[model samples]
Each structure stands twice: as structure tokens, then as C-alpha cells.
Target chain A: MMFLSFVKKEFLHIFRDPRTMLITLGMPVAQIILFGFAITTEVKNVRMAVFDPSHDISTQRIISRMQASEYFDMTQVLHTADDINSAFNKGKAELVAVFSDRFDENLLRAGKASVQLIADATDPNQAAMLTAYASNIIADYRQELLREHRIPFLIEPEIQMLYNPQMKSAYNFVPGVMGLILTLICAMMTSIAIVREKEVGTMEALLVSPLRPVWIILAKVAPYFTLSIVNIISILLLSVFVLDVPVSGSMFWLAVVALMFIIVALLLGIVISSVATTQVTAMLASGMLLMMPVLLLSGMIFPIENMPVILQWISNIIPARWFITAVRKVMIEGLGVSYVAKELAILAGMAVFLIAVSVKTFKIRLS
Target chain B: MKKAIEVENLTKRFGSFTAVNAISFDVAQGEIFGFLGANGAGKTTAMRMLCGLSRPTSGKGAVAGFDMIRQPEEIKRHIGYMSQRFSLYEDLAVWENIRLFAGIYGVPEKEIAPRTDGMLARIGFESGRNTRVKELPLGWKQKLSFAVAIFHEPKIVFLDEPTGGVDPLTRRRFWEMIYDAADRGISVFVTTHYMDEAEYCNRVSIMVDGRIDALDTPKNLKQQFGVRSMDEVFHRLARENALTSNAN
Candidate 1:
């Protein structure tokens, strides 16, 4: 009963402040949309080539669709698999869309088909965006095929983004955005909300009450926890609908894993609030101590593998690194729960360790 | 009268510094017990020990019959507290603040609304129940906080320097509220450096350099110190420590 009051009070604190409400809800939508469109390497009217050996109706339809889209203008038709490499080497075409043999026959017979997109990856950003657009077109075509026919037609665009790949931006950013926003909202906001009470001296009145310290911390966490879940849902929705990122894996497992990530971030917040006496200190600590690591080291911006060996080792310990990896597997790679078991275990361990640390460190008495 | 508090040899110390040293006292039911000291005179440290906020280094204490050390949580449930600084939610309306604290203090849900009305009426703040606490005058804010503190009817309430910077008028009005709470049989454990406020307490314990050097009613303390007022009594006690520290 007392716990309910504490939760209600925290909710009031969040609701009463308009700035907090805006930052909590408005910031994520703006960021994902901005990153999806504004800070993009998206280029238009790219020269393209097709290696459609089958030249069947399915292949012709996809080729015409690719040409009709605003992003691609087909300039050549290659006849050999070997021509894909030379076409890029000779600056003949920026991309090569290679359809499999007997494309329409195989697609109708097996309800599955493949289209290999190869791109000039000398500029990884341009390469990422080109593939993202190309793949989005294919995904839309595949959706049309599913609507027209009853079979589960899997038109898997084989993304050798190592060479060329749509939502390559999606694959990279949707998870990155989730990691960044969750950290900002859960870790930073939770700590600030808690430290604000301490700064106002209300904590003394609270500590003296029958409400247990854990209950107080939980109540503080509860609101942000709910907010972050909302953020997660919205970001995922935006990714699927606006950004065209696929929820290839199980949606239920994706949500479950994301919820675990939220817990880890929220626990980090509790740990930070345990140490920070004021809101400024909490925010700076969260920024310096949590955000920097999440941004630079979580493979959110820079790939962890390409980082220096020591930095790679350090990145392994950053919670977002694990969260992004888990999300990528569950969301983009279309993997199952068992695939992300290690990441989930590590996140669960972090949650437990943080809970223990917060318990030990949270002050019961004022200095 | 039943005892609201009992303690013996309460001492709290840092590594090499003793902030509260072997101090002990008792408060009868419904009495206003003033914990008197200058700034940094160990009064807060001692009170924190009794309130179960700070663990005593070595002491025995009980708040409202609950053992302070072993059952601090139980003691917390039975006692009320107001911090040295203003502690109400500035953004929340007065009625919201009341409902929040009342609920947190485990006031029966059924009694909360009616009691909240009663509290607002008693504090003469019925019309402004919807006023955000930050907009209220600081003095009235303090009064509202005090009313809320005792709203759950805890056996004892520990207030730490509640009137630190209030004007004389507000301080007097604050004291009137304290007297009113005392009449209804709630023990008030208040800490203050104000010598004049000491005169209003049923009993006052004056601490100098971490020890309670004088514990008596204001009239008796004035008589024992051969002084005319509680201010003179305090100076007489603090002056000796001042001289000794200066000599060292």
C-alpha cells in the first residue's frame, strides 16, 4: 500500500514537469526519424546493372521495379557471374543485382528465391544506404508477392553488404538508436529523478517513513521503466514502419530481450543515484560514466571489432555492447531466444551485480 | 505519564572524532523536548541516532518503545519526522502532498481524506489545499509540513532545525502549532540553536562539544546557571568550551 503511494508520487513528479515529459517521449521519435532521414548517407539516382541470366517474368518485374524507383537507374545487363566484379572494377556500374537461375520457376515451385546485390563499398556509408534502399524495394516486392499468392514467398535479398545491402542503415541504426535512447532515458533519467528528491531534502522525510529503501528505489525506477518500455515500443514501430527494418525474429522474444536491456539500464541508474547526491552530479556521472561508453564502445557508432584490441576488450564490458548485439540478433538477424542466451545471461548478471551494489551503496543516513 | 523516549550512553563517532559522546535523556509523553546546541554542537548527530537515521557507535536507545538499534524499521513506522530543511514537494498541490505522505506513513486509507480535510482545517489552509507548496509562504509551508508529519498520529515526531531562518512572527506561529500538537499528546523532539525557542520547550538538553552538559526545564536551567533567561544559560555553557578550546 505504501509502495503504491511512492509510485504515485514519482509518477506525479514525472507528469508535473513538462520538460521531462517532452524529453522522455518527444526525444526518441525525433532522434530515430532524424537519424533515419537527416543524418543519412542516402544518395539518389544511382547507376545500376543487372545480371539477370534467368530473364524470366519475376526477374523482369523486379528489374523494372528497381529501374522505376527514384533511387536506381539500370545502365547495363551483365551475362556472367564473373562480370559482377569487373563491372565494379571498370566503374561501369555502382551496383550489380544478380538473380538466381530459373528465377520465376524456382520462386513459384519452392516459394523461395534469392537476389544477390553487390555494391562498390569503397564508401561504406553510401554502400549502406544504397543497399538499404535496394533491399527495401525488394522487401516491398516480396510483400506484394505474398499478398498476390498464398504461399510464404521468402524473397531473401542476399546482402553481401561487405560488397553492397536496404536497412543496412536500419540494421545498424535501429539497434543503435534503441541503445542510445534507452541509456538516456533509463540510466540518466532514473538517476536524476532519484537525486532530485535527495537534493530537495524530501528524502529525509521519506527515509524516516515505514517505506523500505528498496521500495523507494523501485518506485523511482518504476516510472522510467514504464517510459523506456514505451520508448522501446515506439522505436521498434518506427523502425518497422518508417525505417523499413524487419522484425525478422520473434516479436515476443524481441520484446522480452528489450525488456531485459531496460532492466540493466534501470539498474545502472539506481547505482548512479546511489552515488550522486545532486541531479547535476547524477547527469554528469551518467554521461561520462555511462553515455560515452555506450556511444563509442557499444558498437553503436564504431564497430567493436575494428576498434583497437584493448578498446575491443573494454567494449565487451559495456552493457550496451551486449544489448546491441542481442537486439541485432533478435531483431535483424531473425534469431531465436537460445541464440541470445549469452547476452541475456550477461545482462541478467549485470542487473544482479548492480542491485547488490546499489543495496550496499545507497545511503540510509544523511552525511 | 508514559515515556515517549528512553536512551542511555548514546555515542556516535567518526574514525577519530566523537560527534555525540555518551549523551542520554528521556522524554515524558506529550512533552516538547528541545535538543539545544550551537551549530555543529552534536545535537543533530544525537537526534539522528534516536531517529534511527544514524547508527550509534555504542548506545542504547528506544523511540516510542521500539529498540532504536535492532528494530529501527519498526521505530520508523511508529515515529514521524520533519527534516532540518523544507521537505515538502514544491510542485505538488498541498492536498496531493498530504495524500502522499499520509499514504506513505500507512495512515488508514479510509481515514486519509477526512483526516486530510481535518488537517487542512486545523492549519487554517482549507482554501489553499490546491495551492502548490512552492507558492505558499515559507512559514506556512513549514506549518503544513508539521501538520502532515503528525497527521499519521505517530507517538513521537523529530524535527531538525525546522525554523532555521523564519521571521520572529512565523517562528512564534510555528511554536503555537507545536504547543497544539503537544496538547493532543504527541511527543515532539525538536533541535534548534535558537536560545529563545528553548524557553518554550517542556525540557531542553544543551550540548557543548558533543556532550549534554545541561538537561533541565527552562526555569530550572536558568536558576541553576544563575541566569535570567535560556540565552544566558546557553552562553554560560558554551563560554566554558570556547575558553578551553581557545586555551588549547
Candidate 2:
């Protein structure tokens, strides 16, 4: 009964305070839309230069096709292939496409043409994508030309997309959004609540109560756990209905894993509250301490494999990385529990360690 | 009558600063015992030690029939505390605050409702049970805070300047509530700088320079200091201490 009343009171506070409402709900929506549209791994609208040495009908048609594609915006039609290096050096173009000399002679004689694509490889992923898109356009043009003359190739490479076959950005983002939202709700909110109690001087009342420090800490965090679960359900509903994001695994399993993550987050929040003296300090600490790790290292934005070795090692310690991995396996890949046992066990161990640390810190502070 | 609280040479130090220097006192059940001192005279530190919020550097003590140092949790279960500031949740309604406190104290659900209703009526706050604590006047909030502090019927209630900033009329009404609690055999360990309020206590102790200089009934303190009131007695003792310091 006491626990229920405490939970009810916490909910009342969350409802009454406009700041809490804004941070919990408004910020989640804003971040989702921001990351969905603006902050993305896939680069777009790359500038390019076309060095068409052939100057023939087929070469011009391919150039036109590349321009029509949304991925590339051809801002310049170069006069010389030598200008490619200068254009890229001056940051005018990220990619340059060149066709061999002989105009239409080679294509007419051998029924084949060679094109060289040059890209600024500073950002390797962007360069790779640009190269792939340019090549695909050339391939399409070649296939069309051959079909016009009824020519057929003896050998062809059949294309297949193994993972993320649909290539829908939403499918990639659902797991990320789950990690960010759950961590913020369970960790940041609880820290703020604990610091607020200390600020208002009511913590002294609880400290003086017959309630043990461990019980008090548990009671303080219990409400946020409940709310975070509710938020998880809300996000799931929004993902399925609004975003049309699919969950391939068991919903029950997903919920169980998410609850375990929430528990870990709550313990982390308690540890933060123990070190912070005020609400502002706690909020800043949680944001810098937890949010940054989740954002950068959780495989939500950056690919951990492509990162520097040092950074990859750094990412290994971030709890959100493991949770996001688990979630994606269950949701996107539809992997079973047996397949994700290692990640789940690591998360469970992390939760236990965090709870133990929080308990020790709470007891020390009480003493 | 059993002693509700007892302390012998109870001391508390904060690093190099001696906040409470070997303070000693006793409170009988159903008695109003006041610890009187000027600001920073260590009244709070001593009271916190008795309330089991702060540890004493040295000495032994017992509160509410339990050892204060070895078994703080037990002492907590048997006592209530209302800090100098109004510590109740400002966003919570009067009845909700009552319910929350009662709940935290582990009051059974079936009895909480009636007890809360009865408490609100007894405090003459039945009409405003739904009002948020922040919206109420300072006096009303102080009264409400006091009622919440003792709602669990702990063996002893600690009021650390509970009447600060309250008007005289409200302070009197608050004392009436305190007196009623005391009459029910609940000891009151109150600390206040209000010289007028000191007269209401069954026994009063005045501290100077982190040490209790005098402890006695109000009449005895007045007679021993050859003063007409507790204020004059306090003034005389403080003036004497200042003179001794100057001589040193």
C-alpha cells in the first residue's frame, strides 16, 4: 500500500510539473524526428563532376540518368578529365565520373565500354555509396542499350540484399529509439527526482524515517521503472502504427529484455544521484555520463566496426551498445533467445553490478 | 514514568569544527523539553543526534527506549521529525501528504483513510484537505507539517524550530497541538530560539559556545538568574559568557 501511494505521488509530481512533461515526452518526439530526418548515417545530395571523354549518345544518356537520380546532383559538366582532381581538391565535388577516349569506336567494335569513377575517399562510407550509385546507373544504361538490340549476356551477377532487405531507415532506427528513450526515462528522470527531493529538504524526512536507505532508494526508483515501461509500450505502439516498423520476435521477450535494461538504468541513476548535490548537477551528469555513450557508441549512429580500434574498445563498455544489439537481433533479425544469450547475460551482469554499486554508495552516503 | 530520551556527554564534530560539545540531557515521557540556543549554537546538531540523523562523535545515548548509536533504525521507527523548513511536498494536497506519510510509516491501508480524515479534522483542515501545500499560507503549512510529522504516533516527536516565521496566534495554536500530543504521553524534543516559547517546555536547556550551560524548569531558570522571564534569563547568561570571554 505504501509503495502504491509513493508511486501515485510520483506520478502526480510528473504530471504537475511542466518541465518533466516536456523533457519526457516532448524531447523524445523531437529527438526521434531529428535523428530520423536530419541526423543520419546515409549521406545525400553529394556534388559530382562528369568527365565524359566519349562525348557520344550513350555517354550523354548515362550522364543524364545520373543527374536524374536523387542521390547525385551534377553541378558541373567538366571540359577536361584533368580538372577532376582540382574540382575535388577545391571541395567543389565529392565524386567525379570519367569515360575513356575513342568516343563510340570502342563500344561499336567490342560492344563494351570502360568508365573510371573517382571519388574523394576522405569519408570512406560516403565514397563507397557514391561509387555504388554511379556504377548502378551505368549498369542500368548498359542493360537498356543491350535490350534495344536484343543482346543477352552469357553471365550476369544476380543481386541480393541479405540484411535489412527492405532498406527502410525506420527498421534501423526503432532499436536505437528504444535505447535512447528507455535510458533517458529510467536514468535521467530518476536522478532528477532524487536530486529534487534533496533540494526541497524532504530527503531529510525520509532519511530520518524508519525506512532503510536501500528500501528508500528502491521506492524512489520504482515509479520511474513503471513509467519507463509505459513509455516502452507507447513507443512500440507508435513504431508499429505510425512508423510501420515491424517487430519480428516475440513481444513478450522484447518486454522482458527492456525491463532488464530499465532496471540497469535505474541503478545507474541512483549512483548518479548519490554523487550529485542538486537537480541541475544530476541532470548534467546523467546527460554527459549516460546519454553521450548511448548516442555515440550504441551503434545507433556510428558503425562500431568502422570506428578506430580505440573507439571500438571504448564502445564495448557502453551498456546501450549491448542493449541495442540485443534489441536489433530480436526485432530486426528475429533472432531467438539462444542466439542472444551472450548479450543478455552481459546485460544481466551489468544490471547486477550497477545495483550493487548503487547500494554501496547509498549506504555510504547514509552513514 | 519511562524516560523517552537520555544522553550523557553526546558530542558531534564536523571535521575541525565542534558543533555539539559533549551535550547531555534527558526527557521524560509526556514532557516538553526545549533546547535553547542562539543561531549556530549547535542546537540542531544535538537534536539531529537525538533524532538519529547524525552520529555522535563520542558518548552514549538512548532515544525512545532504544540505543541511539547502535540501533538507529529502531529509534527511527519510534520517533518523528519536522525539520526547520517545511519539508512536506508542496505539490501534494493536504490529504495526499497525510496519506503519503502514513503510508511510508507502513500504516495499513484500511486504517490509513480514517486516520488521515481524523487528522485533517483535528487540525481544523478538513475544508482544505484537497488544497496543495504550496497554495496555503505559511502558518497553515507549518501546522500541517507538524501534524504530518507526528501522524504515525511515534514515541517522541522532534520539532526543530517548527514555528519559525509563523505569526504569534498561529504559534500559540501550534503549541496547543504540541501540548495535546504531550498529554497523550508522546514526548516532545523541540528546539527553538523563541524565548517566549521556552516557557511552555517542562524543562529548558540553554547552550552557549557548543555546551549546555543551564538546564532546568522555566521557573527555576528565572529564579536562579534573578530574572522576570526566560528572555531575561537567556540575556543574563549570554552577557555573563561574553564578559568571561573578554576577561580571558
TM-score of each: 0.81, 0.84
Please give the DockQ score of every candidate, comma-separated: 0.49, 0.62
Q: lDDT at A97 for candidate 2?
A: 78
Off by over 4 Å in 1: A40-125, A128-167, A363-367, B246-248
For residues A1-367, what per-residue lDDT tens digits would candidate 2 score against the true structure?
6566777788889889998888777765676566555643676788988887669887788789988988898988888867877887688888787777763566767665677777765444456567788888878977786788666422121222212223334466678888898889888999999888998889888888877676667777877787787777777777777667778897877877887788888888888999899999999999998999898877776656657889889888777888888888888788888877887898899988987888788777755
RMSD values for the candidates in order, in angstroms, are: 8.6, 4.6
Q: Write the per-residue lDDT of candidate 1 for residues B195-234, one digit (tens) a residue.
A: 7899899999988989999999999999998989999999
* Whole-model lDDT values for every prediction: 0.87, 0.82
Q: After the best TM-score superposition of candidate 1, give how far the Cα of residue B18 lies from its true spot, in angstroms.
A: 2.4
Q: Report candidate 1's fraction of native contacts.
A: 0.88
Q: What are the clashing pairs of model 1?
A: A131-A165, A131-A166, A132-A166, A132-A167, A167-A170
**lDDT tens digits by residue: candidate 2, B55-171:** 899999999999988998789888988977777999998888988988888777788788888888888788998999999999888888888888889989999888988778888
